[model samples]
Target: MSTTTTDIALAPGTWAIDPTHTEVGFVTRHLMVSKVRGSFREVSGTVEVAEDITKSVVDVTAQIASVDTGNADRDTHLKSGDFFDAEQFPTMTFRSTAFDGETLTGDLTIKDVTKSVTFDVDFGGVGQDPWGNTKAGFEATATVNRKDWGLTWNAAVEGGGVLVSDKISLTIDVQLAKQA
Candidate 1:
C-alpha cells in the first residue's frame, strides 16, 4: 500500500510471525552450472519493535527436518549428516543483535555452530488485513559460506568443479501480526 518509513512507523510491540504468510528460503549453485533453491516448510519467529526501531529485536527458528526442494530424495539428503544432520541438529536459529535501518545483524546457528551474519532488509511497510489484524512485512537477503557451518560434504564433478558450491544465498520474506 506504499506505506513508507516516514508515513508509517512500525508499531512498538511484539509481533508474532504468521508462518502461513512467511517464507524462509535459500539458493545455492549446483554442479557449478545451475542453481538449486529450497525452503524450510516450518518456521516460527517473533519481532519485538521498540519505540525507537533501532532497539527492536528478531528471533527465528526453522525446522531442519521440514526442508523441501521439490525433490523428496534431495530433501532427504539435505537433512542427512551431509548437510543439516536433522537427527542431531533438528533446527536452525537466528537471533538479531542489531538493526540499523538498512542492515540487520544476527547470530545464525546451524548444526550447533553460531556465526554472526548481516542481512540487507527491506521494510515492505505496515497494513491491516481484512481480518483487522495489524501486519508488517519485510524482505531480507544474505549470503554465507556453507562450509563455515561445517556442511562440507560435496562430490567432484566428472568433468570439473564440484557438485555443490560453497556459497549459499538466504532469502526471507516475513509477515508479522501484532500480538494482543
Candidate 2:
C-alpha cells in the first residue's frame, strides 16, 4: 500500500518491534551462480514516529551469533574470524537518519564499521490486533556491499569469481506494537 504523510501521522509515538513476528534476513550470490539466504533468529528494535513524519526514526540490532543459514557448519564459519567474528563483534546495528514516507536512510554498523545506507520501505498499514494492541507493519529492503562492512572473507572458485558475492541484499519485515 502507498504510505502517505497521513498514514504515518496516524502511527505517531513509540512502537516496540515484535521479534516473534519480525524477520531480519539477507541474501547473496554464491559461486557467482547460485544464491544463499539466511536470517538472524534474534533481533530487537524500536520505531518512533514524530508528529512530523519526516522526523521518524528506527533503531535495530541483530545478534551475529544467531545467524542461521540452515547448515550448522556454514553458520559456524559465519561467526568465525573469517566473517563476522562474533566473539569480537557480537552485534550489528542500524539507526535511521532520515525518513520521507517511501525512503528511509540510516547508518548501519557491522564489525565496528558504520556506513550510510538507504532502504525502500513499504508501510503495510496500522491496525489493532485481536488482543486489542495497536500495531503497524513495514517491509524494507536494501542492497549493500559486504566488503564495506569488513565481511570480505572469500575463496576463489576454480571456474571464476569468488565463493561469495560482494553485494548483500537485506530485507526486514517488522511488526511493531505501539507502546503506551
Candidate 3:
C-alpha cells in the first residue's frame, strides 16, 4: 500500500502494529524485597522512523483501564484516584521528542499528568518472517520513582522499607511490521 513506506525516511510511513504479537508491560518492586510485574491488555500505535530513530519519530498510546496485574482487587485500586484514576485520565501515552542512539527522550502522560521521561532503548534489528513479511524489534525500559508520577499510595513497614517501594520499572518489548 502507498500509505506505507519502503525507504527508511526520517519519518516512517504509517505502520499498524499487531497488538497480539506486541507487548506493553511493566515491573515494580514489592517492599524492596522482590518484583511484581504486569502488562496492559490493550495497546495500539504507529512508528515513524524517518532516519534511524534518533532522528526518527514515534508515537504510542495505551488504554489505562486495560491494566492487569493478575489480581482483581489491586487493579481496581490502581484505577481509583489514588493511583491511575482511569476515569479522569482514560489513556496514558508517549510521543518521542528526541533520541540519541539507544537513549530516547519522550513525553509520557499518565493519570492526567504529563512529563518528560528518558528510557534506554535497544534496537533488536529488523527481519523477515518465513512469509517474507518484514519486521523490526526493539526493547525500551526505564525505572522511576512512583512519587514522581504522583502514584504515592503506600503503607509504612515497621521493619524497614515501606509496604511497597517507591521505585517502579517499566519495560516494553515491541515488534513492528514494515511496509509490505
Candidate 4:
C-alpha cells in the first residue's frame, strides 16, 4: 500500500536535513566489472512537508569538494576537470518537482547541466532522538547516465571495457528534523 504523509505522523512543517546523519552516495561499475562507491560528506537540504504529503517539496545541495571514496588520489581526480570539475561547478543541486509517497521526481543539476530524474522513495519512518527532537528517515535511489550531466571521463581497460560505466547509481539516505 502507498503511504501518505499523515500515515507516518510526520508533522506538517519545514524539515531541515541533518547533515551529520545524512549520506549522499553513488555507485558505478569500474572496468565494467567491479563497482566503485563514493559519497559526498557535506550536504544540506530541506523538506517542506505540506499538509498534503503528496505536495511535499525537497531541495538539496551537495558540495563537490566533499566527495570521498576512501582513496585520496581517486577522490582528487573526481574533483578535477575530467570529472565533476569542482572548481568550475562547486556544487550539485536537486529540486523536487513531484512526490507521491513512493517516488520523487526532480531536476538534478550538475556541471550546469540539468536533467529530470525519478527516484524510488522508501520512508524509514519518524522517531524522537535523545534530545527530544523529531526526526524522520528516508532512503531514495535512482540511476542515471553520467554523460547526461557532463561527467563523461573514461579510459579503456586492458582487456576490453571502459574504466568507468556510463550509468551511475545514486543512493541517498537522509534524516530530517522538523523545525519549530
Candidate 5:
C-alpha cells in the first residue's frame, strides 16, 4: 500500500510542466453510437520525485468552464445541470493518494461529488526535451459511472434507448517537471 507523499522530493533539479504539451481529457458514450472526446485548456498540476522518478507523486486540477467540444450549443448544454453544471462547480480536482507500481488511487471530485478512483497509471519514465528540460511522463485511464455522481440526465429514445451511457472513460496524459 502506497502512502501519502508527505515528504516528497524534487528529484535533484528544478523543472516545470509545459502546459501546452499536456492533456487533461475525457471520453463518454454519445447516443450509444459514437464517443465524444474533449480536453481542458486551463489545467495546473505538480509532480515530485526523489532522485529518480520511480518514487514520484503527482496531483492535478482543472477548470470546468474551459471545456470545449467545438460547438457552442453543445458546450452550453454541458455547462447545464444535465452534465457538468459548471456554474455551480467551477473546478474538478484529483489528488493522488497512493501509488503502487502500475496502479494509482486518488480522490476525484466533480460537481461537488467526490469518489475514490483508481487508474492504471503507466510511467514513461524521465527524459529530456529538445530544449533541455528534465520531464517525467505518465498516462492514466479509468472508467466510472457518470450517474454515480448524479449526472443522470437523459432522454428516452423512440425505439427504447437512452441518450447517454452511464460509463465515462477518462484519460490523462501528465507531463511533470521537477519544479524550479
Candidate 6:
C-alpha cells in the first residue's frame, strides 16, 4: 500500500535514535535445524519527522565490531575476513526510502554491497518517560539473503545442508527521543 501522510503521526522535528534504549538484532538458521541470534551493541541514527509523516527520512549506522552473539569465539570469527571482515568494513547502514505505516523500505549496506530491503514495522506508540522526555517506539523485522551482502562463509555438515543458512532475519526495536 502507498504511504499516506497520516500513517505515522508524529511531531514535525528531528527525532534522535536512543541507542541506549534500542536494539538491532538478527537471527539465522544454523546447521539447517537450529537458530543463532546476535545483535549490534552500538547504533546511532536519526529520523527527520517532516510535516507530512510519509515524507520523513531515516538514517542509521551500526558498528560491525560491536557484534555480540553470546559466544566470544563466534563473535571474533564474525569480525574476521570469513564473515563481516569488520576491519575493512567497520559499519553497516540503513537509509529509508519509503514508509507505508506498516512497512519501511530502505537501502541496506554491508561489506560494501548495497541492497534494497523492506521491513514490517510495528508502531509501539509515543510516550513520555519519568524524565518527561517524549519517545516513540517501533519494532521492525526483515529477511534477506546473506550472500547478497558478501556474508557467504559456510561449511557442509556431515549429514546434510550447510553449517549456516543463506537467509538472515533482522529485528530492530528502536526508541526515538524527540530532540529540542
State the C-alpha lDDT per candidate: 0.92, 0.92, 0.76, 0.94, 0.75, 0.92
Worst 10 residues of 5 by lDDT: 1-10
- lDDT string, candidate 4, 41-64, tens digits: 999999999888888899999999
* Model 1 lDDT on a 0 to 1 scale: 0.92
Runs in model 6 deviating more than 4 A are 1-7
Highest lDDT model number: 4
In the predicted model 2, the residue pairs found to clash are none
- Candidate 5 lDDT over residue span 1-180, tens digit each: 232233223365434555777888878777788888888777887765446434555667788888877777977888898888899998888877777666777889988888989998766667777987777776888998987788889998777778788888888887776565
For candidate 6, write residues 39-85 as lDDT tens digits: 99999999998877778899999999999999999999999999999
TM-score of 4: 0.96
Would you list the rank order by lDDT, best first?
A: 4, 1, 6, 2, 3, 5
Q: Output the worst ten-in-a-row residue range by lDDT, candidate 2.
A: 2-11
After superposition, the stretches of candidate 4 with alpha carbons farther than 4 Å from their true spots are: 1-6
Q: Residues 1-180, candidate 2, lDDT per residue (tens digit)?
A: 666666664557899999999999999999999999999999998988888989988999999999999999999999999999999999999999998888899999999999999999888888999999988889999999999988889999997799999999999999999999
lDDT of 6: 0.92
Sequence-dependent TM-score of model 6 = 0.96
Q: Give the worst 10-residue stretch by lDDT in candidate 3.
A: 1-10
Q: Give the TM-score of candidate 3.
A: 0.86
Indicate whether candidate 1 or candidate 5 has the larger lDDT.
1
Q: What is the C-alpha RMSD of each candidate to the true structure, in Å?
A: 2.0, 1.2, 5.3, 1.3, 4.4, 2.0
Estimate the lDDT of model 3: 0.76
Q: Residue pairs in steric clash, candidate 4?
A: none
Q: How many residue pairs clash (N, CA or C atoms closer than 3 angstroms) in each of the candidate models, in the order given? A: 0, 0, 6, 0, 1, 0
Q: How far is candidate 5 from the true structure (C-alpha RMSD, Å)?
A: 4.4
